[model samples]
Target: MSDSSDGIAGIPHPNPLRRLTLDQLRRRTSVKWREYPEDVLPLWVAEMDVTLAEPVVRAVTDALALGDTGYPHGTGYAEALSGFAHRRWGWDGLAVARTKAVPDVMTGIVELMRLLTGPGDAVVVNSPVYPPFYPFLGDLDRRVVEAPLGPEGRLDLDAIEDAFHRETAGGRRTALLLCNPQNPTGTVHTAEELTAVAALADRYGARVVADEIHAPLTAPDATFVPYLSVPGGENGFSLMSASKGWNLAGLKAALAIAGPAAAADLARLPGEVVDGPSHLCVIAHTTALREGVDWLDALLAGLDENRRLLTKLLAERLPAVRYRPSQATYLAWLDCRDLGLGDDPAAAFLERGRVALNGGLPFGTGGAGHVRLNLATSPEILTEAVDRMATG
Candidate 1:
């Protein structure tokens, strides 16, 4: 192959609004079904239906060609992340000083448990969150203090503060785990919201771990505030990955960006604890951050269009299913209680409608009667899925 900047297709024009059709994405995944299973649509997982960006594919392929899938060792890995952080979100130099490589967001959360607190310690999580948050904490033998998020699908600062106060009164060590651009709700916390959280965490001597994996997909009307960029955020840790936004979960690369103090805590933990994907993941992660910006922009634009299309379709066709426009990411938080699905519309969709979606209860209590849809597919697929679901 002729030598090019990165052995990938040249960057396309910057059209953040560009997108591939759902049929194209479905064909690319080579999805298998028995006769397409009578109109079944798969939107259960967060996987995107798009092809891998050329730069990311080239990087991974090049690394594999080198024939050693050994452990990663590259200075540029962290630097690329830092550059992406600065360029994408204006958070500078953090990837160098505070970021540490990990296998994925789950590992980071588990590690935070080990690094920040002990068994019986209180960890506050707003309900209706990613399902893994519950088990990840449970497996650590830690006590969970749930601040039940309100009906509006927004975080309640008062409840969070009360949880912290109760924990403090009982003399237990406490920490807060924040899901930014929150999962299953698509509520992107504002700068003020983040600062309010930081204040609560700081006031009680508790640490905050902000999961910002979805920040990259912030839609046009939404604001994605990096938890660490907010005031009092210096005392917290931010966990992120290219996986969620770039369809790179298969790469298994994530980082934990910390403040000086939090970094010290993670550093003191033994190296043996970090078991993750190999050197190829490092190359993919770095390349995605450095040379994949144009592709990411395209992907996000596609996601925005998909979100809008879904909202309009539901409004016009499936009036029973209520949905709000997403501020960031391709996930749609749909309230299906009006359908009388009785707290598990996902199951109804899958069994009755032949459509696969994530049930809301997995996110938290308020998640009941809701379903989270992955809109990373083509618009046609989204429409078909909704059509089948509505008919059911």
Candidate 2:
């Protein structure tokens, strides 16, 4: 609750969660469904098919109106970000001083991947992860030590521990990039699970870069325990954004927080890496934290409703498609091994049903026989998608 810069409030960071009304979402030009003519439901990308809060749009518009689209100063944006973290996660020790403005979560990830380990070194990621995790590590010439997640998309602690030890024993420095409220599966790691991961990473001297962008979107029943808070925790980094929850991804706002230990490592790296798109993101993020809570709560309720609706309809209509219930995010990881779509059901879904969901195989080596559906759309569209896939 301390200020990081002059004139910044010592406390009261903005709350960044909000939901858009149906009519409001319908009106937004950025809404994907409004632009596409294919009639193919866009449940593929993670962007919400909804309008942003009016305040965000206005702030961005005002910025453009003023004709000062210059790059943003970093310190000016810390206050709202600090408040957002505090309000969303009850993170008490989080101060404005620790947060860094970034262009997007993926850019932060790539930078952290470079900062933590050298190319040809290994970085650990649990499957089926967000597909980009692979390229983020691989593009840097780093190896991906894939630890397959357990049934129901649970993180297999034993496999993770084994991977950590094997890499360390081989004289390689490895880092674990965890997706909290994991995409595709929408699994929010439990406290005990996170504690276990922290212990293993600590033992191996590995860093855990927890991607918590989806953490704010978790269902009411689920709890998101930040990875670094556990015992034996070493260097930890948390990457987040209002883009995921508030559907302002196109505005390009994201945050990355590195603890004291990790900050030391970062100090040795180039300064520009931390100085991401601090300006534009700052406006949307500030608006989201200050005035977006009501909309976010409504969004969670809608996503929860959609989750239930999809589950029920899948059980009743598409008996062969097994959709494991999720604790966070609108994406549902499905077992279509029974669907007879052969190895890739995502391709089959698109070709046969005109649905453009993400193919699961790219998530990891273990992701074959699976597909991920984004249920963050209207019930009517969801129903139609189900019927299209099932009837075939």
Candidate 3:
């Protein structure tokens, strides 16, 4: 089959990929839809509004039909990602022998961080990042050092170097948690920027752990360079999955890849950690990696269309609200500082516009005058959302 969200141009469904409808979607139980009352339009969560890729549904359904559920097994999870990396990102060094299956991306990230740091240690992160990064690391007794992003939304290397130096000043080893195609901002890190980061990490003796879960949702034309694929990255760890890309968070399966030098650290992880991934989740993600490419292409197309629609809707309706089209993922970071919505723009939007959005304050430092809007929905809903914000 060719790369398409639907195998064919047109198909029958309660929610066809290209033409998503909220009427058909509110029937579900995802947090995005269920978090608020019917009167409130939900646009806060990272998941999409499109129907599941046909292949993913089939894989999970067939497993349940045959009662194939059990403890996770085999190297299929790693092998699937390896093959996907080769075909999708053109990186082929993913050896199944060097890979391990984790229950989810966040779980894998914390575990890898443990291998590099201990209690009271620090981790350098670009501010206004994924909200969970703070608490997740905090749960492990790790402190976070902010290396705030520049106004243009790109990596601030000087700030990163300063933070890295400060973290290591205590003679304590730290880990650099990188969110490639950075969350909230959707700024795809250039190969040059990443290489410089790697060099900096090497100089400071800090380990690098990249949460690359959003790598698959990258736009068709925007190049996504895998963190471990660049120089000085041979020892960095990469966390990836089909969960975010395919909207399979409930399945809970992810892969953790180690660069050649870091492969030995894989042995440091407790064997019981492998018990995290559900057996069926493995089957679903493996199927997505191997067979869900076409469906993914279609989803990307849908997101691209929604992002463009948001751009026009903002320009015409709420010109005061500044939004930069994301280079990757369906999440849009809005610079609402100009909207006169006070320190917390999201609160104003929810109270006046009846729309739900992620508050920027919780994301740290640079997030004070911003809000995160999920664009993974039908254009009809998107246009209405903008209009509500405009008239409110």
Candidate 4:
């Protein structure tokens, strides 16, 4: 609203973060746009409001132009992601030999769970987590065990070990589905924490399945340690994708990297599991990871500004809505308990302010009275969404 140009709410972002205006974003039929009415701003989902990186767009369009639409071949996605990890996070342990292409991160998780656990077995998850962890693991007939985060939303190592002990008791096979740079809360687990987890999993004999889709979006102030790079982490599985960083979600491609000791299990995956991967997705995701560094950097900068901007906005207009600007990803976990809006503040925001945010209740455990806000949008839109929440 200020049009001050120097910054918005003290977050310096002179470059236009998103190329599209609300009118343009509204024209799309994606879930983020179509989920709510025209008047409502949907900042709930992880979808970015920005356009695709230039290389990704070029790769897709070039493939279409050549009429090269067909099933994917080779381990290009694996190689691409391995290279990305080495360059992006200084993790050089990934080899194409230990990677596999899956339809997406969720698909990879299910397949990995199948390899590690059986039906009716237990799977440990950090609470106030990504909602799909419940249904996805449930579909596998695996039991869901909670290891809720600590009071400050950081990993509760004691709670994790306690859950691992409970779940693995009596030789019951189980897996730990970890969210590094965790979802909703966006607390990037320190390398020390991750190493502790790896050791605990080893001691308890439970496999670790890390869903690190948000690995690349970590803020400059934070460090993202690739699980496999740590000692004892060699037994875990890390799933990653360019879908979040490059806005390639519609293109279905994801990679599951196995540590040295877990390669055999990944190799045991059924062949048919690879059927859902799209060739176009592989090309786009690969191109983005391999060549879209500039665009990705710009996007991260914008996201950094948006995260800071939201902090200032809440402090000024809606101080009651407790928020912590995320260190990774574009999500802001807002503690709305002080608003006295009950367990599901999202509903009230939708009904009253016409702003749609992710409901905290579904995240389970600590989720009640919390809402996860997406900050991957234009500054004006972010301002409008928060303003709507204040009034709503």
lDDT of each: 0.79, 0.75, 0.86, 0.87
Task: Give the poorly placed runs of model 1, Cα more than 4 Å off.
Answer: 1-39, 93-95
Which residue pairs overlap in candidate 4's backbone? Answer: none
Give one clash count per candidate, in the order shown.
3, 10, 1, 0
Residue 190 lDDT, candidate 2, scale 0-100: 82
Positional deviation of residue 140's Cα in model 4 after best superposition, in angstroms? 0.8
For residues 133-243, what per-residue lDDT tens digits would candidate 4 score against the true structure? 999999999999999999888989999999888888899998899998799888899889999999999999989999999998999899998877889999999999989
Q: Where does candidate 2 stray beyond 4 Å?
A: 1-37, 74-76
Better of 2 and 4 by TM-score: 4
Kindly indicate the candidate among 1 and 4 with the higher TM-score. 4
TM-score of candidate 2 versus the correct structure, residues matched by position = 0.89
TM-score for each model = 0.91, 0.89, 0.96, 0.95
Please write out the lDDT profile of model 1 over residues 283-381, one tens digit for every residue. Answer: 887887787777787777777778879989999888988898878878899988998889888888898778988899888778889999988777777
Over the full model, what C-alpha lDDT does candidate 1 score relative to the true structure? 0.79
Global lDDT of model 2: 0.75
Cα error, candidate 2, residue 202 (Å): 1.2
Order of all candidates by lDDT, from best down to worst? 4, 3, 1, 2
Winner on TM-score (1 vs 2): 1
Between 1 and 4, whose lDDT is larger? 4
